[model samples]
Target: MTERSRHLSVHVDRPVAEVYAFASDPANLPLWAPGLGGPLVHEDGAWSVLTPHGRARLEMTPLNEHGVLDHVVTTPSGERVHVPLRVVADGAGSEVVFTLRRAPGTSEEEFEQDAERVNADLALLKQVVEAGAAGGAGGPAGA
Candidate 1:
């Protein structure tokens, strides 16, 4: 069986570095990506959150100048899901792209629901970033 994927993107009225700085911080996940669930807790040199599926561990890529926000979520059942995210320069603004992939045995309806959730998350991200930009803050918490 072939896996399917959807690339959802949103435009933020901020520089790539600013957007990356905000979105790259796990502490800001609750502000935009609420689908990930409650606040992130940093423990034992790792970040974990209380997701709908229970506690899940998150491993994000190190901060870099390349604008890569890739992360892996280890589900309660020990399923490691890779989420590919990026912030690319779009003129003076930036475009955030998130790739949502269909897992094996997932139904079409489930995939569509996932896509919708991602779209909503991206929209929220745009609003938060733009609002912060308007406030003269380079990024979230001035990061």
Candidate 2:
């Protein structure tokens, strides 16, 4: 089958729970997520996100068929993005595994660009969370 995937891993100098608490909450994307803006959320699982290039409305459907938490979001460009978030322990730090898969229609170049942008956001997430963990500047992304 044709597929696209992006794997991003980061070591946050914080407890796994702390890192997971911030990263897992999509609503806080605006505060820490780079190249994206606004996490306007709704009661029915719909969210509005503003990208550097444009805006997107994401509709999330949570599924519990397996032991993992799985969600699918519809991108602003009409592409469905599948995401799997996993948290692992690594001694004094924490490891985050992000698996992204999408179908084709857009060029690989475009995908690569998007990946870079998204990866930058992930890196910022680590920074923001770790920065907060040390009692330096970690506040609710929404707060």
The residue-by-residue lDDT of candidate 1 on 1-143, one tens digit each, is 33998899999988877898788888788889997777789998999999777899999998777788999999999988999999888878989999999999999999999999999999999999888832332332322
Angstrom error of the Cα, residue 133, model 1: value is: 6.4
Clashing pairs in 1: none
Provide the overall lDDT of each model, using Cα atoms, as 2-decimal numbers: 0.85, 0.60
Instruction: Output the number of the lDDT-best candidate.
Output: 1
Superposed Cα RMSD, model 2: 6.0
* lDDT score, candidate 1: 0.85
lDDT of 2 by residue, 1-143 (tens): 34767777777777655665665566666656646556455555567676654666654434222213235556667766666666566676677666655456768887777677667876887888877832322322322
Q: How well does each candidate superpose onto the true structure, as a TM-score?
A: 0.90, 0.68
